[model samples]
Target: MTISAELLPQHVAIIMDGNNRFAKKKHLQKGDGHREGKNVLDPIVEHCRKVGVKALTVYAFSSENWNRPQYEVDLLMKLLEETINEQIPRMIKFQIGLRFIGDRSRLTPELQQLMLQAEQRTATFTEMTLTIAVSYGGMWDIAQTAKTIAQLVKEQKIDVDQVDVDLFAQHVSLGDLPPVDLLIRTGGDYRLSNFLLWQSAYAELYFTETLWPEFTTEELDHAFGVFLGRERRFGKTSEQVQQEKIEN
Candidate 1:
């Protein structure tokens, strides 16, 4: 499953799903499944880095996840704190920039501080950017960006007529990076689940039944292979695209 260099996705986003299902199937505690899922991220990030991916965004915790049982939520927060503490050194060693995109106000003060420290410590890294979405929702991201833009307008910093698709997008999450080239969802899910709505507008979507903890590097290569086989026409016909390629 060697993906052609030209077909490799520059930015890949993942919806990590099926942690609870994986745990249930193993007859283990849900927390254990989450821990395993968290462990899987490091290897996947390493794979992405080795494969020349510029950015990888993972859906870690959603804003709607707070509706779960309190104990589970608490366990998740604890896991996040511990994972952040452990990954900081690895990130620096690998030269991977660590960043979080989401509403941080809901995160514990300690976790917030740790996240900030991780981001600051790896700010100079250039190998790859790893973005974890915690307490994040696509709708929330869009709304927050709109709010910020509205504030600027109110302050007379910008005119309403200046607002366009590009201007609006500049305020959205991950606005400075390349648009998502591929979006992978595991655990048999077929939906985006409110993850990166604006950024994934034209992304190639891949879904799999493999649980997060069990999704392997081989599987990732398979996804890339599939991506390479697709003919991306955007809005043009296949003949038109082929003709343009030939002319170029």
Candidate 2:
């Protein structure tokens, strides 16, 4: 399935899930699913770029992921390091800028170094942006942004009354990217799972039973179709929304 030109989202975010469960179902080791999922990331990201998406944000790892077994976490970090090392050239070839969002403190020095290298290598690309959220949480993002805003106010950089939505957003991760127009979750999930709370306030959401390792371009096209059918009011009445112009 191909996304219709009229229905594609400029900015799409995804919560990639069910790797461990999928591996268990297949009688594979816990980390095997993650490896398979990682293999799929490059293809899906390229698909998004080809389909005219301006930005893509993927929830690779959450802050709560640290609660998992130490072995799993270690394996995941290693997988992350390898993914970055292998994918940087691909990102550059696709003209896709890379950005990392989330707490980097938990990552090992080597992994952190790889992340920086990936971002720097792809910084000049402008066709699209791919953000990998590692050790991320929606509430955590908001709390951190709030703390930054408070500190700014204390320094008299801005007044307390000046802290509005736009100002708050400036401090959040990937604030330079446009608002997320669509949010999808794979693995039969139906929740946000602490991914992008403030950014996805009005994003159209799509849930599918396909696991992260199995999500394909066709699945993404179907999700776009579903997104097209909805009326995005953005807190306005239907009558008010229809009167406005939305670019395809």
Candidate 3:
């Protein structure tokens, strides 16, 4: 049966965590887990497309990840380059707009060029959007937004008194898309881990014990089911919301 798009989240952001733990459990190297997790990404993306999800954001790497072993970091960079190069054609073919949110200044110039190429190639796409959060931290995004707003203030583009939530949101990286409706964290983690701190302010949080490498479409559905069972009051009483709808 085709799941109703309304039942599926319009925008879902996932923190792809627990790769190292998954690897350790399987008696494999840490990078091996990440490699295996990479294999699952395409399938998850396809599942989101199938479910009519408008936008999907994945926490691929964090700004703090730079503290990891240099060798692992180097391997991850190579993997990121290879993955983007391999996936661009597929993304374009599938009409999935590709977006990257993070500090690209930390990436190698070659890799940064590849990222730009991917974004440009898929810019015309209007289907689903797949955003990878690489070298990203929610605090960094917020700080960057503040810095931009400060610059705008200096330029006299807007009065400092006019700064508000909506204006700040406009400067966020994923602001063009719908606010995050669901946020998923896998591998037993129960925290946001600095992914989309602003966007997920009212998002439904779903945590699964399944590792990223083992997470499947069925698991995705389970998360959706969980979300569907919730009541989104959005700061209003249920009775108040119902009454407002009735009045409308």
Model 1 local distance difference test score: 0.92
TM-score of each: 0.97, 0.95, 0.96
lDDT of 2 at 184: 95
Q: Which candidate has the top score in lDDT?
A: 1
Give per-residue CA lDDT, model 2, range 194-246, as digits (tens): 99999998899999999999998888888888988899987899877776754
In model 3, the clashing pairs are: none
Give Cα-based local distance difference scores for all models.
Answer: 0.92, 0.89, 0.91
Query: What TM-score would you give candidate 1 relative to the actual structure?
Result: 0.97
Candidate number with greatest TM-score: 1
Lowest lDDT block of 10, candidate 2: 239-248
lDDT of 1 by residue, 27-86 (tens): 997688998898998889999988888999999999999999999899989988888888
Tell me, what's the RMSD of every candidate?
1.1, 1.8, 1.3
Cα lDDT tens digits, model 3, 92-120, are: 77999998999999899998999999999
Q: How far is 153's C-alpha from truth in model 2 (Å)?
A: 0.8
TM-score of 3: 0.96
Task: Give the per-residue Cα lDDT of candidate 2 at 117.
Answer: 87
Number of backbone collisions per candidate: 0, 0, 0
